[model samples]
Target: MKIGLFGGSFNPVHNGHIKIAEFAYKTLGLDKIYFIPTAISPFKKKNQVAADNDRINMLNLALENFNYNSEVSLFEIKRGGVSYTFETIRYFKKKFPNDELFFIMGSDLLPKFHKWEYVEEMTQSCQFVVYKRSKNINKINAKKYGIKIMNNPIFDESSTKVRQGQLALVDVKVNNYIGNNFLYAKEIIHSLLTAKRAKHCVAAAEFAVLLAKSIKYDAKKAYYAGLFHDICKELDENESRAFISQFVENAYDRKLFPNYKLHQLAGALWFKHIYMNDDEEIYNAIKIHTSLALELSTLDKILYIADKICDGRAFAGVQKLRQLALENFDECFKQVVQRNIDYNLAKNITFSDEQNEINNKWSK
Candidate 1:
């Protein structure tokens, strides 16, 4: 019997893992494939993975619809220590002495394969089948290590990106699993904001979705951008200023605004660092939520308008602005910008360079 042993931290297996497994199964003619989830990877940082059971369950959920022969093994998880590939391979070799064993991995790991424990013994025990991970130059020579490269499709999906709320890239089951478990809920957004502010965030998310759908933007992205837009609204002024000073450009200009008004930029940096969210649309929307820009994308405008018209807001003329937002976003945004400028002028509030630039360009 021919068997393929695929192992990883699998932190939470995404579609990329599934694609690689299928490619290995077909190209290598393996009789069965075993997915070995590690309790602790020697190569990865300690406590970086999800709980062992949670990782296993997610792997099970991901493989439920798999057509090829596959099974998940908890041998490493049961071992209760740092998982070494050589130990697992030795155990499998003893069990399947007469069977041929192949180790499957991505090409990116090829460079580090030499650093693994007992590489010579493991290579003698089984052949390695590697698939491409990316177009980056391979630092290690595969021929020197006797590794076979398999022709497989490139998978750009990442588990880290999925955990950051890029749900569209993963399988529906995976998305549902994350949502049901509240795995990626932005805790900072909930913890930092008061109950009233949290309620406002929820309302803003709903309105963002409405505006996004009307304008053909991604509703989910809009929702998250809105939800986290006020994350730093209640943070200590010193902390907010510190974060803005470090991550946000034009920090000195931003300091001109009142602390309450600086949360938009602070919140954007906070989400980027905490959630590992690099989506420009979401980041820009959060950054400019309190201060509408002269030029805005559909998502930017949606979040700006949603923050003002969310049901939790009780300002005068909010109802009319809400109606106008759904009817014509450009017109509604112009009104919002003008209203803010008028209010600021009345209070003699100084504007930042970016704010003044927008007002000068659009306040006609």
Candidate 2:
């Protein structure tokens, strides 16, 4: 009987971890692989990892399709405090004294392996299996410690990338789990908006997902763009003007319109500066969510259309526009923009120079 102990924070476990586990199971002929999600990792900051239960749940979701014999252990999490490899190895060794134990880790950790507590005793107690990362294991050093390196398919993914809204990089189950739990919900932006505005954001995000899927765009990014589209909408006139002054070149020009109309530009700047969002697609989508642009990306068009037709909106012809959006996005977008122009004319609403320029360009 042989057992493989794969331990990590498993902070929203990604494909890399699963790939390594499968490779080890087949190559090593292990009877069972235990995924040990740590309560706290000594190497990571407190804020860097998700809640203990959240991580465990994500790991479970990731492992549901595994054909091999595998199970998650809460030993380190139950033990509480800092999780040490030596203690975990000793506990497992005592549990199955007769069975061979193999501890799995990535090659990136090899350089720091000597720093681990009771390294000598732990090595003698269990065989070490190293999965290749970018670094190559030193054969001499590895042989000296009786460590075996397994060559497996390399998946370049990190939990940090996933946390930053790269949801498409992860498994569909993991993505669904994160969304269901609102695991990394942007509380700051949500807190800033009013209740009604928050509801509208959610509805827009749902609609954006559908629109994004129709065009093969990344739906998660679209969802996020929609969710934060109106984050600055609730700010008072003075506050909105002050905030926009720092980002937009001609902030004073924004004062000409009703203050509410400036939120799109303000929200884009907020996302860039506060949220540290580097995705230009998301930034541009947020920027043009309110007014039309002469040239719009697929994402920009999707967010604009989603905001207008989302369930919360109840204007004349909205239902028709929503249906048109599903069947013909380009035509739907053209009509929606035209509707906005017509509504503005009916209400005698003033348009900004940028808006007028865009309208004139598109009208031609």
Candidate 3:
């Protein structure tokens, strides 16, 4: 039978992983698939992993209700060492010598495949199926390695971005998917009636939504993520961490970058505390809005950058970023980020790697 092998840390699975898997099932006419999450990965530092059981549970939570035949493989967990794709492929090869096994991975990873451990052995053993990351991005030259690419795929929705606290304005599909059915705009209205801190949340929410819209983001999620951004800042660190712990169970997504007292994280928790349940997208946008910049989702950038550029805030160079917000979005984004970097440079404050990457990508 033809099958695909999808493996990753799945520190916490995000919508993109599920979307790609679904795409594979529909287009590839696969018979079945195995999601083999590594017990540990050696490529990077050991991520701050939740228990293997917890990781598995979150995946199970994420994978529910798919029509395709699928099963979570436990081989990596059973072996219990730094997980390598080559090693896993070897095991699968031995188990299914005659079966057609396609390995699914992203375009970004394909460039580095040749550098992998026993790369020749792995590539020769199985056919490679690749997917485009963003509509704007394209891959070339990698096809020489026997790679077949998937077209018109969504990029930027990555687990790495999720962990680092980057949030965006969620769109309607995401809003409806939440199951609660309340959009961020409605959530803001509700939070106002309930919380005393809700007053400032309006301005915060406005700034976030405006920024997201300026950047062409989903306005609804941006509004709510912004509205709830500062709802938890008044809480103590222990309370904040507790809130984060309660809300963001995606361990890998949580650790790709550092977590500071970013409002997105707090806002997400406040959503659950007041609302009883959450849309996964909103919860994540809140969870990671500080660091990971992937997807640049509407609420993510709006809440992070808008907190500074909005009209009411009195700060140095406020006129520049604010003035440029509508006129030239990219310039406005770069200026806001440049000001932050210049400010840090003056004080010699250690800049986050994320902040650094932001400066580089936008300013460049």
Off by over 4 Å in 1: 137-141, 186-364
> Once superposed on the true structure, which residue ranges of model 3 sit more than 4 Å away at CA?
135-141, 165-231, 234-364
Off by more than 4 A, model 2: 138-140, 186-227, 230-364
Structural similarity to truth (TM-score) of each candidate:
0.54, 0.56, 0.49
The local distance difference test score of each candidate is: 0.80, 0.82, 0.65
The top-ranked prediction according to TM-score is 2
Model 1: lDDT of residue 239: 75
Model 2, 1-364: lDDT tens digits are: 8999999988779887888899999999999999999888887755557788888888888899988999999999999998999999999999999999999988878877887889999999999998888655656557778899987777788776677656656677777777555565565445566678889999999999999888788999888988889888887777777888886666767455455468888888877755555678888889878876788789988998899889989988899988888888888987887887888899988777877898776544
| Candidate 1 lDDT, 1-364, residue by residue in tens | 9999999988678888998899899899999999999878876764357778778888999999989999999989998788888999998999899999999987878887888779989888899888888876374657767888887778888776665556666566766665445355554345556888888888899899999898888888988888888878886777778778887566656356566468887888766655556577788888878776777778887887888778977878989988998899788878877887887889988877777897777656
* lDDT (C-alpha) at residue 198 in model 2: 83
Order the numbered candidates by TM-score, best leading.
Answer: 2, 1, 3
Best by lDDT: 2
Q: Report how far off residue 282 is in candidate 2 (Å).
A: 17
TM-score of 2: 0.56
